[model samples]
Target: MKSMRAMNVSQPRRIRIANGQGFWGDSVDAPVRLVEEGPLDYLTLDYLAEVTMSILQKQKRRDPARGYATDFVQLIDRILPSLRTKGIKVVANAGGVNPSACRQALVEVAEEHQARGLKIGTVTGDDILDRLEELIASGVGFENMDDGRPITDVLDRIVSANVYIDSFAIAEALARGADIVISGRTTDPGLVLSPLIAEYGWKQDQWSLLAAGTVGGHVVECGAQCTGGNFSRWWEVDGWDRLGYPVLEFAENGEFIVTKHDGTGGLVSVDTVSEQLLYEMGNPKAYLTPDCVVDFTSIQLAQDGKDRVRVSGIRGGEATGTFKVSIAYLEGYKATGQLTVSGPDAVAKAKVCADALWGRLERAGFTYEKTITELVGLDSCHGQIPGPPPDVHEVVLRVGVKDGDRAKVDRFGKELAPLVTSGPPGITGFAGGRPKATEVLGYWPSLIPKDRIVTHVDVEEVQ
Candidate 1:
């Protein structure tokens, strides 16, 4: 197979990019099915989330070889033969907090499958955990974008800090002949857009084209979301048992068609695509990304077929000189405990059980920064907005508390088990043991100048 650089430079009329996995825990079979089911130019998988990076950091701290998403390695092994035979290159941000470790694992997998001559490229330098002190000393405030609080307040408790990188390094890897590109902390859309940029040779200053690619990426970033998995009118969707992930047939001019495999179940319509476009979106007029500032409001969507949607007319502005940073720090500790309350008047009994638990905590001179009590089967989701709760057969009593004192949170966990035996006649479901206090990691969003960071791309053959 020729490298992406040696591919036809005239640009194909359309390129199909498929998203196999959405988040870290998405179905492992999705990628395998994506490669085996139909035609694809690139298979992009997104595995990193703000909390996921922190979890990976904790794993790396415990075992140096275990930080990256291990599922990605397993998935690659499952699809290695198909990927090689079909000449389908892969781009993924499954490295989480450690791209080097992820690349090493892929090398081992390639060798295991006897898939010689496989080039794995890794993009690193997004992680800035060790440089936080130096950056702060250099006047990078690292303030919380939402609250405007300096990171110095929680510097001592920081576990992981990674800047959201763009697609330039990923494109560089593909151009350098990497069959699989692994990136740490790259933006989700960048995983999809990188392949487009590499194949089309889109210039760095192509704001509108970059924005159009970003829009296309955002539509399919969540895997099956744009394919009717989370659609509002889910009843209209077909083949619920075997829903297919999304595929983007992107044109050189930035127009794209959203669809799924030919025989797959799932609906791809204007409504489904629009829902995904509006998801996690802020300021519809100015959607900021590392490569460009996309205007989601200007996008045009149309239902072109039974399960196909065409998206076009996306406009964008020049990108800012800054990159968003995701930082996680230990705020304190929290523990939650739940008990199933059955029999008549279940809701009333559950409320009493919650009050008793907190009362016991207060009696023991324990106070938490926050406390939450909810009836799981009743008003948990809508809170008080749904009016008075309906009378149900049973409800789960859930009590959660967060505090700086771990001992207090631990004490709260002990309160729930006792309630199972002593509080109410119908209380049960405490077989899971006491809910242990866990470190409460808080998210800190900020931005740093793009010039302050440097991304490195390296490709090596698994010979």
Candidate 2:
């Protein structure tokens, strides 16, 4: 458990890190476009979130070889030639709950494309699903971070639990000559930070440098966000059809310029970069990660050129002794159904339809833990902030219910179709059959001692 700074070594003068994929379901062509359009030292992709782990677990339960993000393999197949020619390495957390399977799939794709010399690395030990019970038995309280509830509250229904690891293991894989690194549940910034560590031999104790690298990663982690893809001033952005992905021109001293490939469409200015810096931000002074505690307030941004922003002045502190764990468990069942009501007094009719449906369900002894009724064309999003509802031509009536009892939620689904013929005169748009009850997975955020978890890296050549 040496400090990251303690293992540091010297590296090149500069490195270019580009991020193509933001989340699990981002644009599939973005990764290929990133490799084809530019020169980069590394391409990072982030593909996991809290709810994503549950979905992947269910997929793995149904089929052994299906849990990881299959899109990564398809993208690799499309970009293998460019990757070899450009010598651009890939670092991604597309492993979801199964890094080994993800690495094997990548290896298979490389071999299929005759990319014989490609080396793939797998980082495991983030998953703690099978170890939850053992840890709890060993006096690991595993209490919920928000509610302080113990792990035993939903132990029987838990599906997946993974620790948010850092960049060390990923760096280790790259140090062993891995061309691609597949990891399970590493912190989003770690995917980008690990390359800095692997290439520059950055020591673990170099808090300020690690912090600056993390700030760079956070800015571009969402791919095009800092490049004006999700900017508030959308009209200022050019080329709506092909927004450019992000590229970080990182220096050995931890100063980097955030930009995109040449001739690409997107605005990379101080405003755009500042907007992404506030995304998912908690305390500006103490943005915690497994590698270091980065102080967002210390960051400085400036427009370097037409589509580049220079990011500097980042400061960081030593790392904490614990790791945040994301755990998901079965909460209940939920179903939602919607009907469009048209013509004059549509709002009134929609409200009437919703009441009728709920009345029928309640009369039949079906009580839901939670219920919601929304007028889609009106106050669904703004609520009372929109003020008095306007006289609209049509409003979609959406009703949803959630409960631990599956049968109750299912019964609520069946009650929606009857409203078309029996309850409302202007009701229509119910062609998709009855709304099916789906399992509602609840998220449990917790923390665990760093010593309790162990992470390792394995590298294999495509044969």
TM value for model 2: 0.95
TM-score of every candidate relative to the true structure: 0.96, 0.95
The true-versus-predicted C-alpha distance at residue 212 of model 2, in Å, is 1.3
Candidate 1 global lDDT: 0.91
lDDT of candidate 1 over 1-463, digit per residue (tens):
4666556565567898999999988988888999999999899999988989999999999999888999999899899999999999999998888888898889888999998999999999899998998898998889899999978788889999999988899999999999999999998999988998999999989988999889888888889999988899989999987899999999989999999999999999999998999999989999999999998878998888888898889888999999999999999999888999997999889988988888988998888899999999988887777466577999998889999999988888888888877787888888788999999999999999998899999999988
Worst 10 residues of 2 by lDDT: 4-13
TM-score result, candidate 1: 0.96
Window of ten residues with lowest summed lDDT in model 1: 1-10
| Local distance difference test values of all predictions, in order | 0.91, 0.90
Superposed Cα deviation of residue 457, candidate 1 (Å): 0.8
